[model samples]
Every structure is written in C-alpha cells, then in structure tokens.
Target: MELLFIERISTEQLEDLHRISVHTFRSNYGHLNTPENLQQHINQHLSKERLKTELEHPEMRFFFAWVDGKVVGYSKLNTGQGQTEDYGEDQLEIERIYVLEEYQGNGYGGALIQHAEQQAKTLGKSNIWLGVWEKNPRAIAFYEHIGFRKIGTHTFQVGQDPQTDWVMRLSL
Candidate 1:
C-alpha cells in the first residue's frame, strides 16, 4: 500500500506503459475475449507505438502508477470534444484505467481514480468520466464507491460479441 505513487506518463516510460497494458488486458479480459482477439485489440490500441504517439498528442493525457520503479497500472485521460464526451465544462474523460489482478484488492484502483481526479482538476476540469462494462459488477461497484454514477449506456464490441457499458461520471 505504498499509496500507489502516480504521475503523468513521461517519454521515458512509454514501453513500460505498453508492457503493463498488455498484462492488464490479458489478465482482466482473457475470459471475455479469445486470445487472438485480445492480442489484436491490445496490439492495435495499447501498443508502445500508440502510447508514444498519444503521449505526444496535444489533447490527451496519460498517467501511470508505479511501485519500486515498476509500473503496476495506468489510466488514460482526454479532453472532451466529440461523439463520446463527458459532461463537464472542461470534461476529462478516463479513457482507460487498469490495475494488475494481484494488486487489485489493495486499494490501488482507488488510488488511481483519485490520482486521475487530481490530474483532471489540475487541468481545470470540473468533472471526470468513464465507461464500465455493464457486466463488470465489481468494477461498477468500485466506481460507485469512488462517487461515479451511471448516467448512460453505450455498446462496445467484445471480440465477436456486442457488449454493454454504463457511462459513469464524477464531479471533480
């Protein structure tokens, strides 16, 4: 419980982010997606090259949580603009947030969410939001515990299946 040290991802940590993202995806979604599909999804969206490119983007923010110099998790943030946007005047969307399974029961997810809120606040955002898979009851409960309330629903593709997600929001 080292307070899950969190910070904005730096250029030097792109590879680490990619590595942790793959691990997170595998452990968290292996049951929901086939190996080949998971690999394809993660490789396309969470690869090192994609992280590097996004980190260099002007409108997105990425944060990482580390312990003993090893990244355990990360959350991606973005400014609201188009289609899938948050509801704040300066909305900061939690594009993604993850914690390794082994670290999940130790409050790391809470730390990450709090860190993301602070980061959003730092950017002048008054609210933060994210989408959680509808069937992920544990995740939905955790988000509610952290003060996020479901405001809407959206559909996502999970492998060859369609999935439901609840749009959750929190005031910063």
Candidate 2:
C-alpha cells in the first residue's frame, strides 16, 4: 500500500477541502439524517464561503491526507479562541477529522491523529482533545486506543437534531 501523505492546507486548496469535507460527511452521516437536514448542515458549515472564512482564521489550521496525489482525508485543528470549547491556552482541539469511506479502516485516520499531535506539540500545547459523537463507537474506540480518555460530554447540533459528543483528551 502506498503511504498516505499529510500536508498543511493552503488557501488555493480551500475548494478541495470543501469537496472532501462534504463528501466524507455525507458518506458517514447521510443515512442517519433527513436529506433536508443534511443539506442544511452542509450549506451552513461546509459551504465554500464558510470554509474560506475558516481557512483564513489565524488560530485554526487545516490539513489534508493524500494518497497517490489525491485527497483521501482531512483534519481541522483549533487553538486559542478558535477552539470550540474553552480548554485553555495550552490545549489544542481536533475540531474535525474525517477520512473518505473508501479509506476507512486504513491507517489514514491514525496518521491524521498523529499529525494533530505533532501540530499541538509545535504550538507548545500540552494536551490535544476532540469531541467525537457519542454514537460513533468506532471513532471513540480509535481515540481510546490512541490514549485519549473520555473527559466529558457535550451537545452538538446537526441542523435540527441535537446529538451528544464524547469529549476525549490525550495528554502529551
């Protein structure tokens, strides 16, 4: 198998991030959400304009995972005020990490997590954290297997549906 490559996302790659963000999101959650709700969520969060704004934000960073020159996954990390929750200045949040369905079960996800940790270390963060949807046992297990511990739970909104997310953290 070709090794997956990780790179920091550039402004020119915003549209690619948008595309993979939507594709991976829908592929993973479309079945559980109403079509209208899913579309609404996508439009609100993954639209090109919104992603551009996010990409321009100084405290947030985005990266892409590539295989044979094609984007196969992506991740978003937040620090300072960009963090979704107030976890302090020494913490970095893994706000988003998704691998395309075809790449699931491969090591891309782990590679992304390792990338996030390295980013955190570079930023002088002592801990890395993220909120995984409670219903996503697979993701939760992956995090746990990677040394993250469930510290708490929070509510996340996907259109009209309110979902619970397990707040997991790893001390570096």
Candidate 3:
C-alpha cells in the first residue's frame, strides 16, 4: 500500500483547496440534491473567496491527504470561535472530511480522522466532534467504527434545504 501523507494546507494553496472541496462535495452529495441547490451550496460555502478567508483563520485548519503526489482527500478542523457550534474550549470540531469516490474503502478516511485526533490532542482538546449528514449512513458507520458516539442532532443548511446531521463525538 502506498503511504498516505496528510499535510496542513496554507493560504497559498487556496486554488487547490477550492478545486478539491467543490469536486469532492459535489461528487458525494450532488446525486441526492437538485442542481440548483448544489450550485447554491457550493457558491455560498466552497467559493474560492470563502475558502481563502477560512484558510487564514487562526482557529480553523485545513489538511490535504496526498498519495504519490496526488491529492485524494481533505479535512477541516475547527477550534475556539471557528467552530460552527460552541462545543466549549476542550473540544475540536471536524467541520468537513471528504475522500474522493475512487479512494473510498482505502483507509484514507480513517487516516484523516486519526490526523484530526492528533491535532485535537496537540491543541489540548479533550474531545473531537463532527456532524455527519443523517443520509450518509456509510460515513456514520465509519465514525461509529472509530469509536465516535452520537450525541445529538443539528440542522445543516445546504442552500435552502435544511438537512439533519447527527452530532458525533470522541473523547481523547
């Protein structure tokens, strides 16, 4: 197996970040949503400008997963005020984690979560959490297999659609 390398992304890599963000997201969720809704969601949330701003945020971090010099996945981690919900100072939120469809079942997702765990521990956070769309059973199962437990539910907006997400947490 090829080694999967994960590295923190910088503001200078905004274009690569934006490209993968939109591609992975649309590939994962586009089939389940209308074109208009998908477009709206991408424009509002994954726009280059928005991503650039986020890349510069002190409390937020983005990481790219690379295999043989090719990017295959990415994750977004948040702490402090950057978190969508205030889970308190001792928790780190994994706002996003997406692996390209071709890379599914290859252990990249687990590696990303492991990287997130290391980051959380480095930040002195006692727990790590995330909101997974209720519709994505595969992802929910993956998180559960990694010892995350469902703690609650939250509404995640994608365009005008209000989607339900299960809040899952793992204590470090």
Give the range where candidate 1 is weakest over 10 consecutive residues by summed lDDT: 80-89
lDDT of 2 by residue, 1-172 (tens): 4688899898899878988999988998999889988998999999999999999999999999999988889999999999999999999999999988888888889999999999999999999999999989999889999999999999888998889999999999
For model 3, what is the C-alpha lDDT against the true structure?
0.95
| Candidate 3 residue-wise lDDT, 1-172, digit = tens | 4799999999989999999999998999999998988999999999999999999999999999999999999999999999999999999999999998898889999999999999999999999999999999989999999999999999999888999999999999
Best by lDDT: 3
lDDT of 3 at 151: 99
lDDT of each: 0.80, 0.92, 0.95
On TM-score, the leading prediction is: 3
**Candidate 2: lDDT of 98?**
94
Give the poorly placed runs of model 3, Cα more than 4 Å off.
none
Between candidates 2 and 3, the lDDT winner: 3
lDDT of 3 at 107: 92
Which residues of candidate 1, in runs, are more than 4 Å off?
A: 81-89
**Clash number by candidate, in order:** 0, 0, 0
Q: After superposition, how far is residue 103 of candidate 3 from its true place, in Å?
A: 1.1
